[model samples]
Target: MTPAAPETIAPGVLRLTAPNPGPMTGPGTNSYVVGTGPCVIVDPGVDDDTHLEALVAAAPGAIEAVLVTHAHPDHTGGARRLAARLGVPVRGCDLALAQPYDPDHRVDAPLADGDVLDLGAVTLETVHTPGHAADHLCFFAREARLLLAGDTVMADVTVVILPPDGSMSDYLASIARLQAMPIDAIAPGHGRRLDEPAATLAHIVAHREQREAQVRDALAAGPTTARAIAARLYPDLDPRLTGMAATQVEAHLIRLAENGEAARDGESWRAGN
Candidate 1:
């Protein structure tokens, strides 16, 4: 399902949908525009001509900088093309691929806990919410108490924990960090906007805990593989989804092993004290 063109979410922010659809669910990626004068574009979505045109049409002449949440192809694919068209610097924690970004581009801007981007009318505070990826970030609007959550917190599905790049421990820590923030609304990377922001965070936290418990139980029953643990945990889930769930389970197992709750013996895994 191709999503509609760019739509305004607030007075100064517009959400644009990319044309590329993923393998599972979610029809398109989301790109966001913030502020009017000296505007900032976040997560330019997939590299598609239509999505780029839509973003250009929506922002017009005021585009100042492009900000990416992470280095994933879905999110950062259009950054170079869009930045080139706008003749503006593309800024993100990760370096822009292929072409060298403009000297004005702030790649190492040091996005610590309370760093804020004052984009004329609106101010976006950066929260280093890693785990979806090492360089992931979430922007927050203090006035509206709204969180522009990247893949760190999606509405419909769980983000992949592609290890070395992603970590289950960091993901849980990031969720706890966001839960502590005074947020009222959540504009996720995918699916519909979340109304009950706090409740949503709570649900995600609880769900992860439940999955961890299931993994623990499966290990206790007998020496099990990650695939076996995932099968037991998600018994009624689709066959295709099991592969993704297994990746998640493996991440959990790695975390558990690190914490001394589980151990690996060559190909097999077992519960530990």
Candidate 2:
């Protein structure tokens, strides 16, 4: 598939794919410019000079607000610099989201659930979807019913849930909530846009559930670490991605423990009581 590019996707939505494509960031981070006259930028990809110029040039006219979907550096690193150049306030679920990864990312406003940013022609309603990242937010466009699903839902691959901070149970619930919404299509953080949001969301939920079952079976053998279970379930997975696979296994283990389906013994997990 083609990487993200600078193009008008909908009536008032613009997509610009940064050049930082890799395993973590599928086709790099997808930066979206929403609205016509005064636009709201969501997840300005990287902090590179080239990407910043493309974003500013591809934008409509004046940048009213700069919005970050989550705290990941690839998504929010350019937000502060772009905001500074445009002289607009940076908005996000929390200012602290950008602090740890990017100290220079200055957040001017915090977006709460149900908060709406009206840009005359188009309006963006914030939906707090925290699973991939605790502070992840998806913006719903009222007119096109397009969901600017950050890393919460990827356009190509399934959303990767990082454990400890990212919860499998919470991610499942968040996706369920999104399925209930009036989403026509998903403009994800990576890859191309996804259609039939309902089907896609359902598949994601079911896919996670299947993986949870596989982890349970892996645990049935004996007490094991998350990495061990990941190896058992995905033995052929790429070496570099084994860590991510382990994290996902750990997330399922945590959810299973919470549901009394699995028991934890320090770093090792066994079948629940």
Candidate 3:
């Protein structure tokens, strides 16, 4: 498939998608340049040299700051290289988020919640929305009511909430925070730009709740490991997708355990209430 070329989706907002594409990353990671004159690049995508060169060429003006949504490779692989090329510091909620796949690639600054970054023509307000990753961040365009959603929300796919670093509670609360915003459009980390922010957010919220219910029903058959639960929930599951389904089940169970409705004993899980 042809990779996404740099295109201006909104006033001063240009999207450049990387070459990496898969079940998880959709049509590769979307790198965005948000503003004119001195602009801010969000999520520099994978570390392929060609992609980096294309990003630099497509940018409308001097790159003032490089912002990362999270530290995941597909989303941040090119950060350090791009930052060095542009002679600008990488910015994100966690400095670590700016580090590319290479350990030597690192962020120059930390962006705290509520911090406002000026991109010359447009202004981006940092919103710390941890869930997809503990250090995930979303940028809100103050005047335009636009959200640079990153992987916190996707166009067609639901984000995976893995354990340890990923939390269902944080993800849900983060979604709630976005739901409270007066958003005009969401430039997601993958797929197409989303309109009808309120409805889309609602659907995402409901989708998780539905997953929780499915997990609960599957548990009605008794205590089981996440893999067994996945088999029960998705009888026709493709072998390739088993890991994804299992991780999602584990995430839901983690939340259920927190709410005192489930318990984990070794590798098995059972309903507590």
Candidate 4:
């Protein structure tokens, strides 16, 4: 299949979609080039030479740094290679948080919330939005009002929040933080850019709340595992997404328990009194 070429989403931002589309990655991972000259590449995508070449080619000027939103393979897999190619530093946060998932994860330049990346015409501030992943981050282009939202929020489907590394409460709080920001557009890790940033963030919060209610109802029935609750809640969920659904359900259960709205009985969960 012919790879899609890079498209400009903002004044100094260009996006190129990687060719690794699947159930988890809608269309494919989005590798963005931010700034006009001496730019930064966000999410280098999978370590495919062709994809790396495409991302480098899409940049309008010298690639200063390779910024990773999270340590997920699809987003950070090619970061090292891309950075090496351009003689730039790989920037991100909390490598240990994602080492279990991506054992080979590494970051030359560690980032924290509020850290700014000044690239001449474009400036991006890192917002530590942990939930989708413990080290997950969203970069805000202050002048353009465009947010480079990783898995923190997607345009098409809800992000899977698995425990140990992910937390439903964290995810919700991250959303709240983003809602409070001055964002006009969102360039997500997957799918297309979101123009109605406020509405999209609001809808995601409402959806999570509704899903939490359903989980509460499911738990009220009796003590059951997260997988069973998932089956009950998503009666027609795609077979391939079964595990992810269960993980999401588990995340909610964990959150409910944290809030004293539910209790865990071994592998099963029951609604709190």
**1-273: candidate 1 lDDT, tens digit per residue:** 343577777667788877766654286677898876767888888667777777777873488878877777777788877888878776766533332223333353445557788777788898888776777789897767778898887876877776666788999999999988899888888767788988899898888888888888889898989988878777898777888888789888888988999999886799987
Ten contiguous residues with the weakest lDDT in model 1:
95-104
Q: Which residue pairs in model 4 clash with each other?
A: none
* Tens-digit lDDT string for candidate 2 (160-230): 88865688888999998998898899999998898888988988988998998899888888899999988
Clash pairs detected, candidate 3: none
Model 4: residues >4 Å from true position, as ranges? none
On TM-score, the leading prediction is 4
Clashes of each: 0, 0, 0, 0
Q: How does each model score on lDDT?
A: 0.78, 0.85, 0.85, 0.89
Worst 10 residues of 4 by lDDT: 94-103
Is 1 or 4 the stronger prediction by lDDT? Answer: 4
TM-score of each: 0.89, 0.94, 0.93, 0.97
Q: In model 2, which regions exceed 4 Å deviation?
A: 1-5, 95-100, 103-106
RMSD of 4: 1.2
Candidate 4 has an lDDT of 0.89
All candidates: CA RMSD (Å): 4.0, 2.4, 2.4, 1.2
What is residue 10's positional error in candidate 2, in angstroms? 1.0
Ranking by lDDT: 4, 2, 3, 1
